[model samples]
Target: MFAQALRDILQPLPPKCDIPQDEQLQEAMNTLEVIVSLLLKEQFDTWRYEALDGILLTVAQRRDADTAFFGGDCILITDQTVSPIEVEVTLGGGGAGLVRVCCRVGEKQDGKLMRHSYDKEHRYRTLIWQERDPHHELEWMYFVERMYDENGR
Candidate 1:
């Protein structure tokens, strides 16, 4: 159980987009750290984000995936058996009453995910304070800049 706490962030940089890491990234990262901290602080009281297993951050720089694919990728967290807590955050803006954030954790495969672990529920929406936080909307954008194209290698 403890082993699942450690996650490997798999991110690749793109060739077409060539630019040094600037203050923008730092600002985003800072915002993300703060937002994540705030979420964890509040969410921990009822749910445990720390025990969410492994986290995967991915960014694609192409539109082959979809029409609205503005080079965005999904952030995934895998469980012990490699079940996915995939959160797809895109550029969203709307009215004050509506909070624009989509968070999804894929269900367990068929019978079980791994061993005795079986996912009872799947797919959800995470309440985010702002879009500038880590693992939020901008986090995906941060990763997209560092993504590698097909010719990157």
Candidate 2:
């Protein structure tokens, strides 16, 4: 039920729309971060944000997989996954432009469990936050849906 509701809310934009200006892009990322933080807090009282680079490289060696982290460049590493359905909340930048919040999917090479810079072009879904709506009605849904989908629970 939640998945269906979330999917309905995160419908992607039309293919030819213009990219948002820098200010708008910043606003979208901020809004996305806040929404994700709130929802995750509601779902898990222990929710927290760690740095993806640091966590992947060091801290995660002795940490739990359910830990949440801010993956720099507006990406949130929701440490929840199952093989091919790894999920991350990437907002703006990273060649993805500013209008949409991306829910990217990729498999770790050689079944390896390490973080290294790599291209993400395999598969992704996104939700365009409508700049016209200051209330941010639609932007919140993508986090919920993608979190659920990528976590695959």
Number of the top-ranking candidate, with TM-score as the measure: 2
lDDT tens readout by residue for model 1, 16-76: 3322334533343334333333344443342244233333223212111110111111132
Clashing pairs in 2: 50-69
Tell me each candidate's TM-score: 0.26, 0.28
Q: What tens digits encode model 2's per-residue C-alpha lDDT throughout 89-141?
A: 32222222222223322223554332323224111211111122335322221
Candidate 1, residue 113: lDDT: 28
Off by over 4 Å in 1: 1-46, 49-54, 60-83, 90-98, 110-153
lDDT of 1: 0.26
- The local distance difference test score of each candidate is 0.26, 0.29
